[model samples]
Target: MNLLSDSRCGSEEEVRCLLVLPDINILSHSGVSHTVFWLLGIPGLEDQHMWISIPFFISYVIALLGNSLIIFVILTKQSLHGPMYLFLCMLAGADIVLSTSTVPQMLAVFWVHVAEISLDRCITQLFFNYSTFISESGILLVMAFDRYIAICYPLRYSSILTNSLIGKIGVAIFLRSYGTIIPIILLLKRLTFCKSNILTNATCKYIVLAPVSCDDIRINIWYGFFVLMSTVVLDIVLILHAVFRIPSQDVRHKALNTCGSHVYVIILFYGPGIFTTHTQRFEHHIAPHIHILLSNVCVPIPISEAIKTQALLS
Candidate 1:
């Protein structure tokens, strides 16, 4: 039974075939089976897809334009060449990558009824989606530290956070982001996804795809959880701790003022993220479409907020 021999298996009926294939050996025997996964875009809402796609289209456009402008302004303007603006540029770049990673595929699933994704493309998307997210979290933490030094120790700000230091921090952020994610991809590639390849969302996510495999996914789940806690949660804790260390009210206010945009960006990025993670774990009764909607909504908020924040700062 060569799964790849049939055209229907590569198209609309892929999920049905995947669900019906009972034997793992049958899938693995040919060495070419199960190369594609079917993405279910907002399951149970096939009729309302046009309406649902409107918001996604608008959000993607706004995010792309807004983040691009931020990057452009930061790069072209000589006056904006500082540690703070450099971090914002990195954030904007991450937002662009993150948004681009998911939105186009989502649009294809929504508008063209194209839901089948090859494993390689799916894994590539998954890698960029997560690596950019981890990078964004790291950049936010660096921005917080930048604010801390600027306000808490204004005299030593330039001496401590020099361009060389900022460059080193940027490299560290890239290493930290990509280093943690490479193992997840390796783990994913090792799994044999002989079970149903129907993903509940329009885009590929680690949590969504990990369960479709017949092999054990406990390590993937645990490591993903660890990365979330160590990066974003720890960053939030350290940022708050630093904010409280300023003894004087005026200094505290100033520090917080500088961090206000970043704080809002953090809230916008992580608030829905935490909610979605909890819902996925504890609220299994929730409709799959709701998960898709929440995931889509969460990606664009940071770019929108970044644009607003940069406007105010300028």
Candidate 2:
């Protein structure tokens, strides 16, 4: 930890309590005593930390501003109270939480090298990060269903997706995403972090943090796998079903125009995730720093801009 103590006191020991750095502690599996865990920036590219942060910081700022704009427009404009726009507002909120949960820690690690995080704080970050991520997926799925209803049952769309129903969906996503995470978090309590405390990734994550545990985490791993596959696979199947049921070319065009930018954003959101999984699987062959960098900036960069583009075109 770097010292930022007050020199006017004239005693180094007295000012040692004012460490500006994070409490550098990462938890591991069962065995020894653990407390603060340290996080690392890109390993091989440590010298270029400032350079890496340029784009990461830019993306973080953009995601915040864009999503905030989305929420503002949707909330202020009563005309945008329909299901699709309402869901977009939910998604915008989720994305903002998602990006905020990760980017600050990453920038702290990159620019100031402040990577000290206690076990409690680490677990908190992990929960908020993963919960918001999964919630975003659920929101996207709901949006897909919104489009499906709009295109397939045009006459019944409003009746089916009433304001009350939208409220229920938002609540359900809140419950489901956090519900899935709470159990995993409780399960983590059973394990002792006996392994290395140094995390290779830029931020705290279940996948990265779980491996450092000395206990068997098969249940945690399997549950995570199930949630991920279930969400993505179900989305694909539902979207395909929606597309095949369109009545005519005009309906198809309407569908495309309605959610085409959304499709792009989904791809942008999940593409890095899929690739990050592969990179971790093939870590021996690939540079690990690349994976860390990818993880840090997983906030889809051009997503809000794409929505604006679609709006302008319309």
Best by TM-score: 1
Model 1: weakest 10-residue lDDT segment is: 22-31
Clashing pairs in 1: none
Tens-place lDDT per residue, model 2, 240-303, is 5676567797887777666554555666776676677655644546667667656655663645
Best by lDDT: 1
Residue 295 shift from truth in candidate 2, angstroms: 2.3
Stretches of candidate 2 above 4 Å error?
1-30, 247-264, 278-284, 300-314
How does each model score on TM-score?
A: 0.86, 0.83
Shift of residue 204 alpha carbon in model 2, Å: 0.7
Q: What is the lDDT of residue 274 in candidate 1?
A: 68
lDDT of each: 0.78, 0.71
Model 2 Cα RMSD, Å?
6.2
- The per-residue C-alpha lDDT of model 1 at residue 133 equals 89
